[model samples]
Target: MSTTAPIRLGTRRSALAQAQSGHVAEALSAIAGRPVELVPIVSEGDTNRASLSEIGGTGIFANLLREALVAGKCDILVHSLKDLPTAMPPELVIAATPARVDARDVVITRDGTPLHELRTGSAIGTGAPRRIAQVRRRAPHAKVVDIRGNVDSRLARVESGDLDAVILAAAGLSRLGSESTLHREELGLAEWPTAPGQGALAVETTVDAPAELLAALAELEDEDTRLAITVERAILAGLDVGCQAPMAAHAVVSGDSVRVRAVVYEPNGEGRIGLDVTESLNRGYIRRNGSGNEANAADGADPMRTARDIGDSAAHRLLEQGAADFLPRE
Candidate 1:
């Protein structure tokens, strides 16, 4: 706690990465009463403009930063939770994820048009397999094209007539301050559930991090956000799927129950295995504190176990209903 050196937070040099890390730095600084400097690290993913599937690596945005962390080049690493692989290395962990923003995807189109109003056969650009499947399912006539770039660059395609529309994370656009100025439509979550942890940030550190730093970071953890994403990712892990595959999972916490919905799509986007399941967190969380209430709520439950159960059960339900048939082959 007495270290005079500011904590170096490693991040990709992209504008979005800088912005997200900058936000985390401010929060951590306040919590630790110490300075947090954002250290820009160029990730291989940032360097490669090819499609993610073409690149063929997991945690494209995060692995490079992780290398830096392990090498003592940075004290902290921030990642888009969705870009993080479902499995964490034994030496590493996500220490915190601030409260989540909108977890839904949005479409930005030329002429300020929404998805339903777009013309037939229009080229809609997106690099994500999950988005491609949903787009094809909801708008059968539109064409899905692979695209690679930052938020602004992708948005520019629509302006320059290279594409009639583009799909992006509403959370990213909002963080970059471009959500309101552009014409966009937020997709319905029921039909277009997003990636496991889309819209959430992952704050990673080594398992043996300084106790002071770990405690400070924990102050920023949002239990609700963590549990929701954990459930989504657990379902993914239970199904043994990769990010490049066509899959989407969404979780919502309502009262005492957590409702989780997941879908695994055929590569062609012509079919899918969709299922929804709910799990009660009451037993796992409430009994920990003798006089449990809102102030004591966060630590009151073992949400991680509950989330795993929900995810595993949901994936099992889908498998029972033939989810495996639609999954992409290894």
Candidate 2:
């Protein structure tokens, strides 16, 4: 708990993960007046050759890091918010969410061709179910190849002519300083909503973390970013779908209002359902609890409460419109 001691930040060993964690470490060091060191941890997702769905989806990348945190191997864990499961360990808390970057996905092609312009049968590489569904819907002529690897390896496929293009998150490329060098076409969120919490980072620690560390982390929190991701994730949680579900939800906060858009797609991308809704926050309302339930808001006007309500409402509408029919059944 000493202010001079180095804060250990646990992170996945991937280049992208390290880059993101390093940024957070630098910020924390400046705020806490202490050294912040990276603690690289290898996760199952990194070692497994199988597809994400086959190996438990995105959560595979986070479980080991959470374990290390709980076992005291690291004082904190930095996670790509999208990779976290809806349910977290009871002992842990996501203490801070730095301001988010671009939440849009991008198509990187060998010749810089936009996705819609790709020739028939052109191979497009990506392993995420949401992207697979999106690509099939957006460019029916192109072939969707299930592929998995780090960003460099995926991009290398396009560079080596093994694949015509690959879909990747814009944020990952920006964080790794590879965006400018690539021939990418950004996918707008209006038509291609990304996974919940995409482009955001989650800094987590034990509920019992030292007061000094918690205070330092609070300095990193971005209220608007947290509220937006919270709404998006609430939709995911309300749907009760696994991380591999072909679903996308995005939320944006503007002034006193927040708008959320969500979609559900069939595995083949043939059938889909979507909803868009917005709500205004009462400036005078206050958050009363951490649990996202309605009871957490004193008068049902709290911003966080409004976020959860709107998200839950959107999910309920989707279900009513038979969104469940298009999702994978457990």
Candidate 3:
């Protein structure tokens, strides 16, 4: 038997998952000074793509990997932060959140066509309820179809002449070096606020893991990203919503501050709520102490509690502003 021990890194079988896991594994290898082998785990999300709503939520993607970690099948699990549920199982913990990539949404079209230039009646494909609601609000004429699959499959649908365009996360395309497929004009944050934690990679481990491992993994934590996502996830949890709702939020770290924006939509383009909230970290309670939890008398007890407070506050304002009852009966 060989003397060296390999750390097993569990991930889904999709190209995006493999690419993401490979990147994380490389970092872990360099940090640990040892070999880390990626073990592809075919998840329920991969096998059951009939409908996300019909199954569970996007949490399906993280479930199996978390299971693998708990079962001693793997030492670590890497996930797209957006796909992970706000509340983790008691036994698992999000050990680290590395530096984030592009966190905006991008539109991909055939022949590199722009959204406005597409045929008036052309069909646009997307799987996200948030994207559909936002796209419909912007382009009321286009026929929106629900297209689900891995990134490659979704992009392939456009190339197969079945879709005029599709919306995807800019981070994924950047990671895969597939920017050639994007339409430059629609890549702005004003046009599309990304899903919470869209471009971030999260590392998860069993709660009972050795402190040495946790501490080692925690070295990769990006405080700016953790704070940004904390606010984003807070917005989501505040809304009492999951991936099923038409919700989008994004935050940017600007010199000891974070500017967060959130939006909610009705499916038929009737009602919407949006806000640009800024917190100056250097001037706030977080400046003295690293946690924003200190600034939450108005928001609630915790950071997420405050986020929920802000989300509800925004939702109520939107409702008052005549946000229509376009929420679908799913």
Candidate 4:
């Protein structure tokens, strides 16, 4: 839509970032009938070797890209949805949410050891409190060490004998095309639901973008995937938590309802509060995108309202179960 220049898509410079941006660029080119330029920006997260949360959590990765957007250095931004904050500036908006990839987490271990099969007291490297808590609960004997690095770097720790295993998001490994080559054990979604919005991509654009460009990009939005993520994020928002929170959520749509399973964990993995709730999507304006059926249309419940309702219900339910007791003490 910009007659003066090609649309620029900004992203981080790491291999996974490049891979993700390249993918979005290709899809945008195909859908918009115009090629999009990829602008690789180096984020503080890429340069800082310290703990991600210490430096400022995953938002460090989004800061530079967002700055580029506000400064008019790029026309759009593609971020891992899980890394994005729960709230955003009104001037910037997520314009498109393409179909999400697998959202489960996986364990990468030496000699192809599954999680439960790991030797007692074995060292496992990971920094995510959510993962640490779940690892502690599921494999209490294994030593969970705080780790910081990219997918390959973390996996290298296991390969080099620094740790017996490491836990990582399956989405990253798959995006980098290393899943097939690694010894992986996918954690159960029911037990380890993964971070909210994990495996999903968010395409952000300025509020002032051309209406035509916005509409074209919106075509990439998959309503079902977006709805599922909405449930997850909405729950997080209701809890007033961010990406660094020790929480996990997963949603699945069936018939005219969305079932959201979520958890809140204590910092030390000593306890947890969890809930699984299903809400009907038939209150007003039946959803025509996902699992569309004449039956769904017959009810007339609002899908958006239902999504928020399910998320709010889950949050309140967890709170009633003493979710606050599980929060990592400041």
Candidate 5:
């Protein structure tokens, strides 16, 4: 591939998706010294008005974009990491994961009322099972409305008096610059761990992408962000649950250590199970070599392997606690 050739980036047509893709395109263009073009692709999730679970879970959002990539309609695809299924197609690879932003959900209300303070029967809008379960546990009296739309339309419902409040990912609002005007209260991660890979973006390309493109993507990757989401997604995979399941997993990497917290809730939110675990990383064995390539584990103690082990351990503990009983039957 020529260094000056334009890179076609495929993305969903939603405002939030476009904004996120635009950011990635600009960054890649700078790094690769080439033009990056946005190729908006409509997805099944956008066309279907049904709830995410009713249709096919959040994975519907990625199917068309992945197809466009596979068919050579685009050189790369940008996806909201949380929307992707844990089991990826064999032909594609997540080439880069940039730095993550806020991984918390926020409550947007017309009157700036806190989520728990909403009046009895007040309507709260959200389609995510995780958010629905959290809202029910926190404000049992409030009516949970399943909503499907772009961020602007969802917020419009609250402003138009159709809904008292709506829950959304803080990252989406931040990306779209929609948070400044809204009266939002960010939910704390400790009390409300968000879905795995929330607030992160995935840059994916076919496994056979040009070596130059792969090298540019490697320059775009952030080591810490990749490692953290790796643990979260690994936990999700180990649990054997789909995106629609009412499960939340969050992992944070600190100096030489990572902490992972996960929870599973019943659909009605009456019951739940959670676990918090932290493990130390052997930094001495997992430091980057002098060649500036990938980190070399001197003793063969890979950081990514450690992250997966942490997630797998947490999933096993949750299973021991009967966390699967809280989830919907397959």
Candidate 6:
């Protein structure tokens, strides 16, 4: 393939998205032996700062990119894996998800104050239902407020004293080189499993993308990374919950198997249930090299059944242990 026809990569206008997409483009260029171009598409999530639920949840991030792809405005779309809806449109599929970044959340505050040390009734800001749920459980007394924007804009709130502290993904901050401003709290997955597919980037393409384009993306796929996200998202799709719902999940690849850690929390984060499950990713999960099919666990497994198992076997177990009463009852 010639480096002449640039692969128009679609991405959100946020700094995090740009940086992450830039990284993806560079990696893809190296793999394809050609240059790739990025096309910034302002999404509904960006245009409207309203509640994610009001804007139709996290799927909005994919809408514009999919539109661009369908319209031939861009050849490829890139997104934060966590933000992509569990179910995708039939025409657009995730072609590749390079190895993930830090798959954890970080709390940003002035003077490096830990979450537990904040003054009574101090306000904690976050736009994500998952963070709201998890933090409230850890510090029930702290006030939780919804806030949004790119990482810098959100942190500005704390810097300006508008918020006592704010929670954001550690990966985005690290990607932006702003890790120094935040106190990285390594919340264990058992206590705070992340959203499904968190800390990863998904490269998308039309279902009928040219075979050469598909071959170019092959250089970006990582098997272990694929397996980890597959099971985590598999658990999410199994739950039948939209991104607006209060859900948290994390998965990692062990030696020869994959283990998924997840949580389902109340909106207030006071009540929750979470669990961990390990299965052989190598067993049924296909691993392919160069120009082969990518396994994202998109509906291959029965989500309802897996969710029930995770809820009953893993999550419900936590509930039966009186863990479900931490937050307000539904």
Lowest-lDDT window of 10 residues in candidate 3? 295-304
Model 5 misplacement above 4 A: 284-297
Q: Can you give the TM-score per candidate against the true fold? A: 0.92, 0.94, 0.85, 0.91, 0.95, 0.84
Q: What lDDT is reached at residue 225 by model 1?
A: 86
Predict model 2's lDDT versus the native. Answer: 0.89
Q: 33-84 in candidate 6: lDDT tens per residue?
A: 7789999998888888786644547577778778888998998998888888
What's the true lDDT of residue 115 in model 6?
84
Off by over 4 Å in 3: 1-4, 53-56, 179-185, 282-330
Q: Model 6 scores what on Cα lDDT?
A: 0.75
Clash numbers, per candidate: 1, 0, 3, 7, 0, 5
The sequence of per-residue lDDT tens digits that candidate 2 reaches over residues 48-131 is 879765655747889999999999999999999999998878999999999999999999987788998999999999888888
The reply for model 2, stretches above 4 Å from the true place, is: 179-181, 284-301
Instruction: Give the alpha carbon lDDT tens digit for every residue of 1-330 in model 1.
Output: 356679889999999989888999999998888999988999888888888767754677778889999888988898989888888989898999899999899888766777866789999998888888778887788888999998988888888889998999988987887643457888888878999988999899999999988998899898888888988888888887776668889998776688888998876678988987777866334333555553354554666787888888888888898878876654
- CA lDDT for candidate 3: 0.75
Higher-scoring candidate on TM-score, 3 or 6: 3
lDDT of 1: 0.84
Clashing pairs in 4: 282-301, 283-300, 283-301, 283-302, 284-300, 284-301, 284-302
